[model samples]
Target: MSPRAQPRGKLANWGSSFLPGAYAGSYVNIGSMKPDAVIADLKNGSLNRSEQRKQADLLAKLNRGFLARREKDAQIEAGIEAMEMAFRMQFSVPDVFDISKESQATRDLYGDSEYAKGCLIARRLVERGVRTVQLSHSIDGYDIAWDTGHGDIKGGHARLAKACDQGIAALLKDLKTRGLLDETLVVWGGEFGRAPTSEGKNGRDHDHYGFTVWMAGGGVKPGYSYGATDMFGCSAVENRVHVHDLHATILNQMGLDHEQLTYRYSGRDYRLTDVHGKVVKDVIA
Candidate 1:
């Protein structure tokens, strides 16, 4: 009962943490927590020091089985298979990371590289009934994957773009071919976009003022573009869509009312839109 205790937002469900969205599970840090303790410790960081230490040790063992070079092959494979099965129980694709010969064509079409492989895998996941799939540009914890301006923009983008262009184009083409495009939503964008004014060298810096992000399928009107930037592409000029708006539009397409999709916690309701979202009707069918 203090003024500072005023309700600020809506409540949310603990399980909704698994919900798919823009960055679907991006912020989770499983570094020092065991798989069993993930949800519990993540939500309530009040575990005793001893309990925390135990969790950390379990996590270390799990990491070794998955990444340690000295670990036995049998142990690693077993761990992987178990994890795959667990993922299957919740996700539509029971195989989790299973790859097939038929996927070779899809992979090649996406570019036959890691990026392409990932995109191809994403296509497979969505096709198998997964609601949302997110593929980050980072190949191996290297931000340089997309932070091209750091050095060699031409070479960097060329290497990455070859795969990206193929993967994205193939995904769009494949989705349409199979009629999955209507039910599946595809989003392509990053935290922000690169600046239009070349870094005066080769690459460009981050430009939040204006950038480009496109969405296809999932009830979105095809061949229709949204928003525009200035001549220099430094700022949004017309029909600018904010990130919150994008989230709103996505939730809408999923048949969830952004405002009503609430989770109750601590006597309040919390929703992803968080008081700021307008369904961009123009972008929807």
Candidate 2:
């Protein structure tokens, strides 16, 4: 998906619009959840049997009310799945987010930044059956620092790259070691790339025409590069894969037919790729 007004907004878009019903019920922000408190509550057994029964009853009532209002089976299933996820998270969140339980070497591999922690958490989530896990790199509230603008391009990019390089490499390596890499797709890229020409003396502007995005594992050929940009890196020169094509390729990897994965909204069927996209099968393993 494309970047939105804010990182959270982009996340919301992915949850609400990109895959539509598939993820509408699973949107969560780890930043807002106090995992320690959750763990404490779980350990303390604060809810008595009677209180637990009451809460369950209330949840069932709410589920019934929700199902009554929704016509689509997918919507009903989404609500049920959300409820199940909430129940599962009560146990999973504590274990998954607890990086302290990991070995010192593992921790060192991922470094010690919040962003790096997020990447580690993403791997945990995937291992625990999470369909999608987005790790955003918006340090100090800058959503797209890769924009470069009038900043020092080499220094800025290098700093950000250094911050995430070890963590990402660690994540991929860990996944491979666990035999999960074959099934887990890892995509790396920005919303757009920087321009070939300098914006100022040392910075660059946005370049939408030619940008590089890479995907690994999940049925994609390893160590393979598809498509190309011009000599100046200003435009796509060969095997151009549009955004829609990328979406389609990802869906294909997930065993989904992009055209058939539609949700009904506002009296029409909406899909992630709109009315466009062709699976770039050449990239498939």
Candidate 3:
């Protein structure tokens, strides 16, 4: 099964009393509420909470208002205002909004696609002081997405590879150009790689035994490939980096000792790497 993108579900709980400058739809957690009840609450201004709950409530109310109005001419205007407020609360900005369109040259450089846009946006967000930015290669648009084995492995991998190559290359180049590559880590990979063998009808099943992932900058050794897979790419043959090892490596980059970063839970010290993890010394710069 494909891992869930986010464990928190569709509703994100900001839980902060203060509103942020910007927010995504994923930032609000609206529990069960009937249309009538939602409308009544919004009209009464009972949705405001002292903490982050207010942010969630605001989003819920805005959505309810939009639906209640169902005004053909007023829909766009209403949504625009809601977005302005939502962005202000989520991102902590007073009135900043993304209004400019990408130029032809910029679009061409980034491949003129959503995935590319996402990669480019990641750089922008991080440059603006966002702690972390993740660019997920989702299976949308582009007839040939990952999960190559399902139909034409070659076709899917080709599309995915091209997009990744262009998008990742652009990100690295931009980060380097801005001198952010040294501190900004870029990871490219999937949960697992496709199987080496073909299914009965030309599809490939999930194989967790071995896969490929890449990391650039953030003090990671450059042009260096770590670990190896067997001839069939079915099993890790050398320098195996388990999922825990990856976690430990990430923690080490952030200046936290994997063994020392622990939380007491259930009367036991729980760590990100659990009881297993080495610093992955060879990969560190």
Point to the candidate with the largest TM-score.
2
Number of clashing pairs per prediction, in order: 8, 0, 16
lDDT of each: 0.62, 0.74, 0.62
Q: Quote the positional error of residue 10 for candidate 2 in Å.
A: 4.6
In angstroms, how far off is 53's CA in candidate 3?
14
Tens-digit per-residue lDDT, 172-279, candidate 2: 898888899999999988778888898868888888999999998798999999999999989998999999999999999999999998877788888878999999
User: How well is each residue in 70-143 modelled by candidate 1, as lDDT tens digits?
Assistant: 65454454455444433334332324334444456765666755555556666766777766665655533353
Error of 3 at 62 (Å): 23
Model 2 worst lDDT window (10 residues): 1-10
Question: Which scores greater on TM-score, model 1 or model 2?
Answer: 2
Q: In candidate 1, list every pair of residues with a backbone clash.
A: 10-269, 10-270, 11-263, 11-264, 11-268, 11-269, 11-270, 12-263
Tell me which residue pairs clash in candidate 2: none
Off by over 4 Å in 1: 1-96, 140-144, 198-200
The local distance difference test score of model 3 is: 0.62
Instruction: Quickly count the clashes in candidate 1.
Output: 8
Provide TM-scores for the models.
Answer: 0.66, 0.82, 0.67
